[model samples]
Target: MADDKSKRDFRDRDRVSADEDYEVEYFAAKAGVTPQQVKELIAKHGNQRETLEREAKALRGNG
Candidate 1:
């Protein structure tokens, strides 16, 4: 469950953060990757901001 905990700490789901919906686009743009690539990154890593950013950087750096 360690990975589950890293998927963001927003437990109360009644209100959704606007940024959460745009995570794919945001990270994709920030990392110069595609939205689909961002989704793939999420699958491999996690939805946590740090994890997503780290993976995005690694992906960009790898290419």
Candidate 2:
């Protein structure tokens, strides 16, 4: 159980690192949502930067 938890934590850390260039926090704030919510959306909808940006824009009422 501990090993599984550790692996999940490592994967989460890696995902955050992979998204480091995306300014997720800034966009999430602009979209009036939590960073984890934006991350989940990105993971669900495909991890494409353009797609995330469009989603963020729409959430922020800019799109």
Candidate 3:
């Protein structure tokens, strides 16, 4: 018999997928920034959620 199980590693949970519009929008809302801003930040910073959050705050003068 073969195993039939699903694996959920969640390895990239801490990173954002800029290619995904929903993820971008979600991060934008969470960070209180616009999607465009989020995209730019992703380009500048390598999709690290924490870094993007900090950058978003700094962009909004909150950090």
Candidate 4:
């Protein structure tokens, strides 16, 4: 399932950067999703590693 966060390396969430193309592309690759998905995740969860990890863990629990 898309919500199953355990399958992904949440550590990649720590890569902080502006909404640049390369940053987005890198993050998308790290998160194992598309660049669009990376943007959406950043928009939805904010660009903080702690925040993303918490949200991801929560999403995992809910999965």
Candidate 1 displacement at residue 20 in angstroms:
6.6
Residue 8 accuracy (lDDT) in model 2: 50
Compose the digit string of candidate 3's lDDT tens values, residues 1-63: 322225546687799888888789999999999999999999999899999988999999953
Model 4 C-alpha lDDT per residue in residues 12-48, reported as the tens digit of each score: 4565444567766765565556677556667897888
Of 1 and 2, the candidate ranking higher by TM-score? 1
Weakest lDDT window of 10 consecutive positions for candidate 4: 1-10
Between candidates 1 and 4, name the one with more favorable TM-score: 1
lDDT of model 2 at position 61: 78
lDDT of 2 by residue, 1-63 (tens): 122433454334322322553556755775676788688767776656556667667666743
Best-performing candidate as measured by TM-score: 3
Candidate order by lDDT, decreasing, is 3, 1, 4, 2
Which sections of candidate 4 miss by over 4 Å? 1-15, 53-63
Segments in model 1 whose C-alpha atoms lie over 4 Å from true places: 1-21
The root-mean-square deviation over C-alpha atoms between each candidate and the true structure, in angstroms, is 8.5, 7.7, 6.4, 11.0
RMSD of 4: 11.0
lDDT of each: 0.62, 0.58, 0.87, 0.60
Higher TM-score: candidate 2 or 3? Answer: 3
| Candidate 3, poorest ten consecutive residues by summed lDDT | 1-10
**Selected candidate, larger lDDT, 1 vs 2:** 1
lDDT of 2: 0.58
